[model samples]
Structure formats: C-alpha cells, structure tokens
Target: MNITHRVSLLCAALPLLSGCALVVNAAPASTATAAPVFEQWRETQHRGGDDLMTAGLGLEGLRASVAPVFSSPALPTADEARRRAIWSSWRGIADLTPGGGFGDRYGSVQSAPGREFSAYARIPGARHPHRVLVQIPDNFDPARRCLVATASSGSRGIYGAIPVAGSWGLAHGCAVAFTDKGAGSDYYDLDAKSGFQADGTPATHGALAFVPEAGTAAHGVAFKHAHSGDNPEADWGRHLVQAVQFGLQALDRAYPQSAPFTSANTRTLGVGVSNGGGAVLRAAEIEGDWFDAMVAGEPNVSIAGAPPLYDFVTQAALLMPCALLAIDDLPQPPVQAQARPLWTQQCAALKANGLVQGDDTDAQAQSARQQLANAGLSDGALRAGAFSTGFDLWRAIAVTYASAYGGFAAGQHPCAYTFSAVGADGKPGAATPEARASWWSEASGIPPGSGVVLVDGNAAHVADDPLRGLRCLHALGTGDSAEAKRVRAGIAKAAANKPRAGLPIVVIHGIDDGLVPSSMTSDRYVPQARAAGAQIAYWRVTNAQHFDSLLAFPDYRKRYVPLLPYMFAAMDQVWAHLEDPTRGLPQDALIETTPRADAPLQPAQLSIPVVSSR
Candidate 1:
C-alpha cells in the first residue's frame, strides 16, 4: 500500500517551468503514503448487463420510482447495495429527462464495462474509514493515460458524483477515482450495537465503517460525518489526495507492465460538485500538483475571509421560512407553500422574540428578508430558500455541521439534536428491519435522507419546525462556551489554504444557487485567486441553481436549467488547455441559458459556447 513504490520521472521539462513546476515524482506528492489503511478490498468486473457508470440500471432504471430490490430483504448482497446506491445517487445529483438535455442530448447512459476496486480505508487519525472506489474502463488506453478523481457532493455516498464526473471520465476512456471524502452511507446502528461491514451489510463488530464511542449516549443511529469526532472537513483535501494515490496504485497493480503511472506522465483531472467541488479546490492547494487541472461546480468552499457555511445556513434557517413568504410567485411554491400555516406562526414567533419588526406576517416577512439580504443572501438566494425551508434542510445542515465543527462525539450535538430513525411521533427510536437493510444503498450520508432523520430534542411539539435548534445553532459560533471555542478552532483547521497563484482552476457556479450563493462563495474566492495571479476561469450560468434534481418538480423545471451541461463544456475546454499549453483558459463569461419551459430541451437552451480549440 506504500505509494512510494511507483516513483516516475518522464516529464523532465516540468522541473523548469515557472508556474507549472511540480514534484515530478522525485518523491510521493502527499502524505497519502503514510495512510490509506485499507481494511478490506474487493475487485469486481462489469460487462454487458452491468457496468461501472450505471451499475447496469442504465437511464431508464435510474428514473424508476423504486430502487433495485435486494434479493433478500434482510440480507441483501453487496452487488444489490452497489446498484441501489448508484441509482439513488444519480437521482439525487443529476437533472435527467429530455427537458434538461439529459437523455437525447447530454448525460448519455452508455455502458462502460470495467474492473472496479473498492475498499474502506482509514486516514491516519480519523476514527471512521472513508470509502474509495476506482474504475478502470475496459477500453482504457495505457499510452494515453488519463485519470479523473472525484469527490461526493454534499454528504452523499460513494457514487454521488457518478452522474457528472464518472460518466464523463468513463466515456473518454479514462480511469475514474471516487472518494466519499470521510463521509458516506456507513451508518452505525446505536441501539443494535451494530454497524456496517465492508460491503454494506450489518455487523455487531470487527472492521466496521463506523461505531459510536463505547460509552456515548447515542439514541438510534449514527453516521461518520456527524459523529466521527474528527471534524473530517479539516482533512477533506487529504482524502482527495489519498484517493488519487489509491487510484494510481490500483492502476499499477492492475497493469503491472504498464507500470508506474505517475503524475509525471499521466494526465489527471479533479472534478466534483458542492462539497466534492470544495474538496478538489482544497486538494489543488495542498497536494503538490497531483492534478493538472480542476473543475468545481457550485462548490461550498470555505476560506479565511468568506463566512463559513454554518454561519449563513444558521441565519437562513431561522429567517428563511418567514422571509420566503414575502417573495411572491415563486416557481416551486405549491410544494413548499403548504408550510404557509407554519410560516405565519413562525413570523409571529420571530416578532415576539424580537428577531424581526412589525406585527403582521407581511411586514415581518419583509423585515426577515431584509435581514437575510444583509447577511449576503442574494435576491435569488433569498428566494431560493423556499426549497430549504420546505425540506428543513438548513436546520439539518446547521445541526450536522455544528457537530462536526465542535468535534462532538456521537449524539453529543448542541441544540439537543441527534441522528436517528424517527417514529411517527417524530421521536428517535430503534430502526425497522427494512430501514436498516436498505440504508447503505438508499441513504445520502446527510440525515433527512432515506430512513434516517435529524431529530430536534428541544422541539418535540413541533416536529416539522426546529426554531429552538436554529436559535442555538445561530448563536453557537460567537458564544464563549468551550463548545464554541472548539468549533472555532476546528473551523480554522478546515479553512482551505489559498490556492497557489499559478494553479489552473475552472469554477462553474449558478447565479441563483441558494445553497452556496456566489456572492458569499465564488464572488469572494475568485477575485482573491485572480489577485494572487492564479490561472482561474470563472463561468457564471444564468437560470441555473445548485440542485438539478429539483428540476423534476413542475415549477422548478420551468424556471431553471441544469448546471451539468455547462460543467461538461468547461471540462472539455479545460481538457483542451491541458492537452496544448497554447489553449488558454476560457474567458469569464455570463452564460444566458434558456429555462425548460414546458417543452422538450433543445441544445439551444443550453447556450454552450463554441469553445475554440485555437
């Protein structure tokens, strides 16, 4: 497992280049050699009926309402878990359907039969092991060696970025490397005193992906990101580096004669979305040019100057529901507007609590909107809060990240929040047989996904609302308590080191991304990068937002375009740049995309520019 075995130095000129000069295999580029403690490794071949990218489900199966069934409900096979995970991941991440240019135009479902090697590898200090999977396409060309390393978006499991990153890499005959980045669907069942074994089946002990501390007072269920007590975000960059190292090592092992495929000769690109995107950007800063280029789409990157995700998310969690009322005629209102009754009560609660001014819901709502606007929430971002408010995503995010930043043990979250399988009364309890069985396949690593839910202990009466939790979470960062200090310290560690000025980065963001707004994210990061003389390309897409899957809803489908089309375009252009140094980064452009307005998608709706290969 030592990464040092494959020392290579084919590119002698790299040592002379001013900006692109890197550790040209004189030594291992990362501390990955010291870690990646693999517990179990499994290799499988995919051909004909099943394949690497789709897991044999293809596009039609991906869109089906129900997931692939486990042969035995109680004891599902590892292959079943893999297929269902891929299916759920695709549904969670991609904006498929002809209306979004998914089926007929882009986001093709061609199968790539390949060999897959996956394992649970523990980082040097992390308690829970992260999942890493590498896919070597059957048609892989060793002479034209190419590798794409990707991270899971949000807290999604292993195949989270498969739709966008995996598909593109496989189609181009490149090896695809994936890492859950210290967070995945490796749930630990607290009540059963059990956790997931290597292949997603339950086990009482022995080399499990996660287990709560022996004496911790966890209630129902647990997952790594919230309970690992490692503040895994701090080491996200290392995770990406480890995945890349693992991939290269796996490739060398697979084709021994093809031998040492180091960064010196192989072209490696890193790409991802949301947290995955952030991981790639963070890796570019820390690792010694392991990647030749990177593309980050709607990434939730945190740095010294930009406010942390918890800071803004907590704010929106408190005010967004009430504020959403003031915005009139949102495209996706009906699905969320059912919460109007609760929103009115929330507005009244805010006024009584002195959080906002005015007696009536209208005035209170407007005041709440203004307050969020002051917190760097763009008009689109404020409007976009409707989805979060409806799903209560902000509340869940605030609690989950607070636990991470504080490095709390399992079930030790502030605001009395806990991860669990909730009963009908919204109380944490033991999981049902079915919930536990399918969790590895169905759950996103974040709670409120699949069977697991985020329970607010303070608000037993209001299961749908988490006002008390939001209040505590909002005040968490600034308070002088020991927990707050711990959170602050961890935040410092998690802040990404400013990328080297010469590193090539292409950042693609939607103008209306409410989850991680550009005003607070890309707008802040890009200028700092450019000021430092970084070779960065910025693409701003109109009528696009962070979550493409939301487009399946009738209203959302009409107003927004998927970001994947442009993400692919940027990848193509960046690949060209990497192929020939003369092809410079794409000029910063504001793409005016056409929304899917109750009609089949035309390539014209995407408005992809002719990326000249001059």
Candidate 2:
C-alpha cells in the first residue's frame, strides 16, 4: 500500500488519544445565503419544567481515581546503582558456577562436588574483566568416552549452554558448563565497565553483550550496545577468540576433576548458533589443542558472506520493511535478485559516510582489489567481486531485532548501544543523515581487537571495515589510523598462531532454518573446519531455526518413562565428554512427543514465536 494510505489505516486502527469536547449550537433561523438549518437537543429548565443540559464529565475527576504503584526512592549508591542497573539489565543465564560459591576466591565446591567452572574471560583495552560461563563435570576416570554438545540459547534466554549445564548436573549425569560466550545479555555483563572517563560516559569497558532481561546470570559484556570508542576492536572474531580461550580456561581450572582430557593429548568438541556458531569455529581454530570435534548451526561467522547475518541484512535492505512481517510474505527468488543492488548501495553508503571504524580497515575490503587480483580477477571483475562481498549488517540488525522480545525493541537496544556514536550527554547519537539517506543503510561494523581490526566481512561490505574508524578518528585522530592497521595486522598474526581447537567442542545446527541460513553452517563452516582438521563433532537438527534446536523437548518427558537407559545413555555421553577426553559425538535424536489437541500443528507456522511484544 502507499505510505499515505497505510499511515491513514494505522491511524484509524489506533485508539484516539482522548475524546474531544463537542460544541453544538441551538437551532436558528438564517438567511438563504447564510448558514444551513441546524438542530439541537432540548435543554431542561432546572427550576421549572425540566430543561437542563448535562455537561460531559471532565478529566479532573478521572485523574483522582488511579494511584501510582511505584514511589521514588533516595538516590542509589554508586555501587548499588551499578548492581541494580546490572541486575535489572540482566537477561538469560546469570552465574553458572559448578557448585555455587559466594564471592572472591574460587572456593571449594559445595554442590556439584567434582564439577569445575570454566570461565570465558574477556579483558578489552582499558575495560573491566568480564567472563562467559563454562562448567565441566568431574572426571574421576580418565579413559571414559565423552561427547561435547554445544548448544545455542533460546531467543529470549541466555546461551542454550545453561540447559547443558543444568542437564549435566541432573539428567545427563555429565560434567558440562555451557558458554555464556556472546557479549549479549544472556550470560555476560557487557555493562561491566571500568569507571567513567573525563567525558562522564562509561569508559571502554567490555564490548557489547547480547540483550533480553529474561534470565538471571549475566553472560559476556553486551557488545551490541558497546561503544567503539573504548573498544577499538569490537569484532565478533575477537569475541570468538575469547570464547575459545574461556572454554580452555574452564577446562584448565576443572582439570582432572571435571575435564580429564589432557589439553596437549586428548580430543575435544564444539557447537552453537548465530553467535555461538561463530564461536564454535573460533574455538576449533584458536584452541585447536583443546577441541577435537565441533558443530555450528546457522552460524554468522563471516559477515560479508552468505551467512544468516549476511542474508538477513541483504534481504532487509532490498525488500520492503513489511515484506517479512508475516511468514507468507517470504521473498521469492525474483525478489531476492532485486535486493542485490540494495545491499551494494548500503555498503557504498557506509563507505561514503566513513561509518566503518577501528584500525583494521586494511584487512579484507581495504585491499579487496589487490587481493582479488592476486586471487586471479581482472581489475573490473575484482571491483565487481569486491562489491559483491561488502558487509553492511545494519539491515540485518533491524531485521533480526525489530520484533518484540528482541533486545532492540525491548528497553536494551543492543544494536544501537554498539553502533551509534555516544555523545557527551551519555546518550547514544543517531546515525548520520548520510548513513540513513537510503532505506538500505549499512548498520555498524564490528569493533576491532588489540591486534585485529574487523572480524568477519567480505569485500562487498566495504563499509563494515571501518565500523570503528570514526571512533578512532574522534579519539586518536588521523595518525591513529595507520597505528590501528598495524594493531590489526598484529592481532591477525597472533590469532593465526593461536588457532582454535584443543578444547571440547560440540556444534548443533538445524538443516532448515527460516531466519538463519542453515546452508552457511552445513556448507561453509563445517567443511572448512574439517579441511582444517578441526577436532569437532557436528549434529544437524533436521528442521528448526537458530534458536529452537536448543530447547529440551517437552514431549520427550511426557511419552518416555523417566530414567530410561537411552536417556541415561544420552546423558552419559554428555557427562563423559565434559569430564574425560574420548572421541565421540552426541547422537542426534528427534524429540519424541505428542502435540496437544487444543493447539494442533500448523504446517504453515513455526509454532515457536520468533518475535513478541511481551
């Protein structure tokens, strides 16, 4: 529909703000050229017969009827405010320690006796230390077989690893601690910032974490809302590296008790979704010594490529906003072909506006032409190829988050928190007009790391290369650009040396995903890992989204008897892997159960709602 018509329809559907008072005049005799005939209701006379007009009730009386529920309290302490702010913002799995401990020291285990907590630690430049949670079961016997089952988090919860953690303790009978790897709200505290700087804004603390306030434990720092000013390298690559390291650390701390596998000698596995899938690859590469098997579901590893994040952005930029509002509106092949230019325009827009940031601008897109030429493309073809792969993920952000329950629509605008520049007022600034001039503007680029600039992107997404460039310019000036490049080069060098693997890794990805493109994982990532000789086991969930595969099947509980050997056997595989170092992958099983009669299956619908206002 046209904008005017749609707006009018929307306005008509909405309830009016308030009723307006109506004024009427009494019937009067007028000249033919004057006013038309008018009719009015009779007025009652109060003292005599009964002629009186009842006035409409005023808002004054209505105002006194309702009472406020919350009362303003005294100003909170800096510490209290920080805690409450953190707590209120907390989503997903909170603290997932093995046998909970109070504070300070890694105290003796009181609950999960032999279990150990593996922490994914991230200490960005000048920021406070924040870690993702990973736990391992006690491995009293070193030779037991094990399986690393990596899990993705639910759409509204922390990383699905928490379920792995809980199940390991109860049903699985395994030593496992899932990762709260993403800087999103699930498991980490992205807001765990260092004190404020002279500008009064929270200093470069940790990068962005994920969002949603559903759970208790804080995962990694919510990088989605993080400022590039503080963290020059805000790319997911660095976070992935950190995730690998954190998984290793958790294994190291748990040692013989939880993880019996010798880092230098034993096998390991990996797994996860979108962010988790990215981490799964990194874990296999960066911690190759620890991961022997791995799997990824709808991973968004390469922003520039045909990953879910890439496709989502591509579709959003080109297609109309309401196109994907309903499932039936999914774009067909012809529509997808039309969106290609929109994605290209988005990249051009980012570059023209210098929206790309940080020091790593020279990595992929920075030298796309030269790289393409080296890879055997002619200048014109190279340029075309470069344009084809540029990463402009802004559309992806809007597409992934515009719905309810997603953090962007929720109070914690994770994407805006990370991308938009922050003003002196502590409020994040809006995107430049130039950036927003086109409906297909590129979103913010990933941040750089100590040595690495951007993490994942392609030549087509040229603008993502400089996501942190403006921040760097604002903070360090033009001279820092070269320095930033050098730093990224160094980081790449370092990351190359520390290839992921060497830890227990398990990946679970669905074959059919509507949001995330499953082909990316099954085709690109898994094969790449195998080519690299990554010690990872992958489980392909036949049909599901990036989120649904991680949930425990309720039907499994209803139909099967409790404590079945197969159930225990499945649990044992997970437990053994968490504790010991033996090569094996979890058996992929379709959750068995009966659907309720009240809620009959709808083939046209993906029963689980992806977006929600509540």
Candidate 3:
C-alpha cells in the first residue's frame, strides 16, 4: 500500500486498539490572499482562547504542565509491539558501549550507574563510524515498547542534540537517541583528521575527507577530509541519510526483544535544531516511512551555494567584526579608521601579487595602488603591532575570530580582509579571483608557480553588483563529473520534497535568526509544501535568535526556556494528529514575545506569504 493509505490504515486501527479519538478535521482551505490568515490568528490570540499554552504562565506553570505527562504510566501492549518491529529489521552492524554517568551534561539526564549508552554504527562506504547515544528511561519495562525520538546535532557536533532530547524526548517519556552524523569534530574540519594520532599525523581512521584547493590558506589545517567518503557516499546529504537509516537499525539491535525494546509498539519521531534540524527534514523527505512525525527548528535546508557563501563572507568580514568590536567597548569611529587603512592595504597587496590586472588607465591604477600602500601597513603587521603595544584591542580580537571561523590562518589572512571593502551603498563588496588569489598568496607567502594550485578565475563569479558577488567558494569538482552527479542526486533525493498528504510537519524558526535566515522556510519551504497540499505548520518566532533557547546564552535562556514546554506540547499535538487524524494540523502563525528576559511566549498571528523565488 502507498504511504498515505498505510497511515490511514494505522489511524483506523488505532481506535480499535486503544479507543483513541480520531478527529478527522478537513485540510486547510486554499486562500487567494495571505494577510487575512495572519490577522485572524492575531484576533484569536487577542481573544485569549485556548492555545498551546495559556497566557501569563511562568516557569513554575511550565514545570507543572510537563511533569505529569513525563511521569505517566507506560502503554505496555503498544510499547512491546513497537520494539519487536524495530529489531525484526535490524542489521546488527553496530557495537554498544556501556553507559555510566550522573547529573545533566549537555542537556541529557544524568544517570547514576548510567542508563545512557553509546552505539557506534559502521557506515558501509565511509571510514568513520556514526555515533548514536541512547538514553533509556529509569522505569524500564522489558515487556513494553517506548517511543523513539532521533535527534541530529548542529555544526557544533553532538552537543546540539542535548536540549531537544532533554526537554522534549526524555521529558515526554520517549527514548532519546542522537547521532554525530559523521561530522564529529567541534568544527567542520576541511582536513579529514579530527582525533589526533600520537605521532602527530592525521589518524587514518578519521572522518571522510573532501579535497581542498591546494593554494588556499584553508588547506593542510588538518590530516584528512572527513566528508569525502568513497565516491557516491562522499557528500554530507548521503551521510545523514545513512546515519538515520542505520541509527534506527543499530538501536533495534542494541535493545533486543528480550530487553526493553519492542519495535511493534514503537513509533519513531525526528527532531533537530540548526544543521541537525536540516537533517531531520531531509530524513523525512527521503525516508518518510521511517518517521511518524518530525520537528525542525531553524534548519539549514539550503546548500552552501552562491547566496549563502556571499552572506558567510560578509558576516565574517564586516558584520561579525563590528559586533565583536562593539562588545569590546571600542568606539565606532576609531575602529572604522583602523579598518579602512587595513582594507586599503589588502587591496594593494592583491594588486601587487599580479592577481588584479588594472583595467583602468596605468596612471590611475598606479596612483590608486600608491594611495592604498601609503594608507598603513598590512592588516597582519597592524595586528602584530597592536598586540605588541597593547593598542587596537577590538581590531585584534575581531581579526582573530574572523580568521578562526572563516577557515584561514591569523595574521595577513586574505579571506578575513579580502572582502571587507564597502561599495556605494555602504555594504561589503565582493572579492574577485585576483583579489582572493592575492589574499591567499600573501597569507601563505607562496609564489604563483610554486607547486600550489590556485582557484580558476571562472570559479570566482563576478556580478554587476558587488553584493551579488558575495558567495562562499564552491567545492572543487562539483559539476558534471560522475561523482558530482551522484552527490547532486543524493542531495536532491534527501531534500525536503512536497510533503505527504497526511504526515504532519511543524517547522519553527526565529525571525531574527542570523545564521539560517527565516525566509528560507517562510519564503521557500513552506510555500512549496503548501502548494503541494501537504499538512504543514510554520511558526515564525519574533525576536528569537538562531541559537536562542537551545543554547545556554544567559539572556536567551531567561526568555526562551519557559517556551520549550509549550513548543514541545504543540509538537505532541501534531504527533497526535498523525495517529488519530483528529487533533488537526497546527495553525501557521507568528509567535510574538517581548525581548525581556522574563517575558512569556505570547504567540501573535502572521501567515507565511507565498512569494516567488528570487
């Protein structure tokens, strides 16, 4: 039977098995205009009717609501059946490590005598194994099966899995499972090496490796490429797909029928934040049969293409530095003055390195070059001089951070300063191939023909507008080749497709999220799903930052922690709809809240307007 038919059958059977209330609400009707829905939702909220959470509730209120559900008794028949189904499909390719710990670490329940264990699943084509942490509840029953929530981590690695697993999965009486998804390091290592060898070379058994351009400063920072697996499995999309598929299989194997896991009664749910959020979405699209429900918070669904690359460079070179400097108590004027001279020097260095062939008159170009050279010493010398004299503290810190995160060496870093120039509109301008080349050469101090391969000029996409030119460098050999074709197909297969008819999906994003812009969801994903007639709910939270609520940012924690219970409760409602089809799909609306640390989660109404893709 088809997926929708199967889901309908399951829903129909649910009533017979447990007297479950099947609420068959009609699908949301299509509208010609979008603004009315937003207004209507606002009206509803203002009316003070029953929503997910009541108005004026505080932390104590949140705890009171959540405690009971988590502490409830098990459904033995359902749990046992679910556990059995999971093990029946197990591949047994993973090894389970015993767990012993206490208290909360990274948001997971601290188990004394360790209820949590690590299962390492070996990927068929990759060198590194995928790691899944399974946290079993205290009240374990061998005869009962439990719900499973598989969480994926963000770019920062498995630490991103803690908040959701703790607040949502564990608290909801479900077994919380998390995967490293192959990128196990704290940072995205361009070099395959993550775990170090005693002899100092990258350990041969590290994550898969991706090839980097030889002449770039980003090269040789590590021992191996963790993303480059054998051929078709090399890309991240396929890795995540494998991680989810085998992660479940491994879990079934680890908790056998004789133990507490019975797949027959179990239902799988997927949840993730940031990159992990993207993984869950992709997994649902690729393997809808595997997951009954999913929640993705601020998922990075789009690839690292031209637009994102541009944003990445601009944020690193201009936006981030300014923010960091401000936090350091540096005045804007002096910092701007320091930055201008540094930018000029970088432009001159690029010209000198034969990277920029001046198209202007020889005299004009020469005068411009002289003017820039005379502005001040290069950024590297300035930073060194500042550190030595204890001057320009903000610039020093800004440059250091920019270099570290932008994947370049500190001092005379090209990528850090190459795109710092402002255009007529006062935004950062794009760096040309020659400029990028100059920056790389200066940073590495390597000559043009000295065995280092430089990026081709064509690869540096030039646009009429400098802002348009801002893009991250694309992966080498990402087009037309056999491997490239395979990677593209894999990514397309795993991307969020037109949602299925009955499967309910709730996507929550922060309006003020700096990392993955909310527009990607509100503008792209939601509209596509809506157009395709999928049961989708999109929540745009006002004034919420990307990492807020999930991470321990003191300001965000105060404002966002109280909202977690409500958010999870909404998700639970969606899951209920999946099983009974009576709970109705969640309404798409804007979640409004004051920025105050003590403010409650007061969701106002706003509809996602359908806009044509840019």
User: Which number leads on lDDT?
Assistant: 1
lDDT of each: 0.79, 0.30, 0.36
Model 1 residue runs over 4 Å out of place are 1-3, 6-37, 214-216, 333-337, 424-427, 460-466
Candidate 3 C-alpha lDDT tens digits along 1-614:
11111112332333123222122233321321110000000001111211111111222222231221111122122222212212211101000111100111112222211134333433443333444445545443434444445444433232235545434555555555665555432111223322321111122254322222323344222211122232211233333443344333323433544422323345666776666667666555543355566777777665322233222223233223222222222222334466644544433433444433453334333443343223322222222122212223222222222232233321123322321222235443332222221221111111111121222223243332221211212121134544334334444433455555555677887665544555534347777767777667787776555533222223333333222332454566666665666446677777655543333222321222221221
CA RMSD (A), model 1? 6.0
User: Model 1, 189-211: lDDT tens per residue?
Assistant: 88887777777776777767677
Off by over 4 Å in 3: 1-114, 122-124, 141-144, 186-264, 303-495, 549-567, 576-581, 598-614
Cα deviation at 498, candidate 1, in Å, is 1.8
Q: Tally clashing residue pairs in candidate 3.
A: 36
Prediction 1 global C-alpha lDDT? 0.79
> How many Å off is the CA of 312 in candidate 1?
0.5
Q: In model 2, what is the error at residue 284, expressed in angstroms?
A: 0.6
How would the candidate models be sorted by TM-score, starting from the highest?
Answer: 1, 3, 2
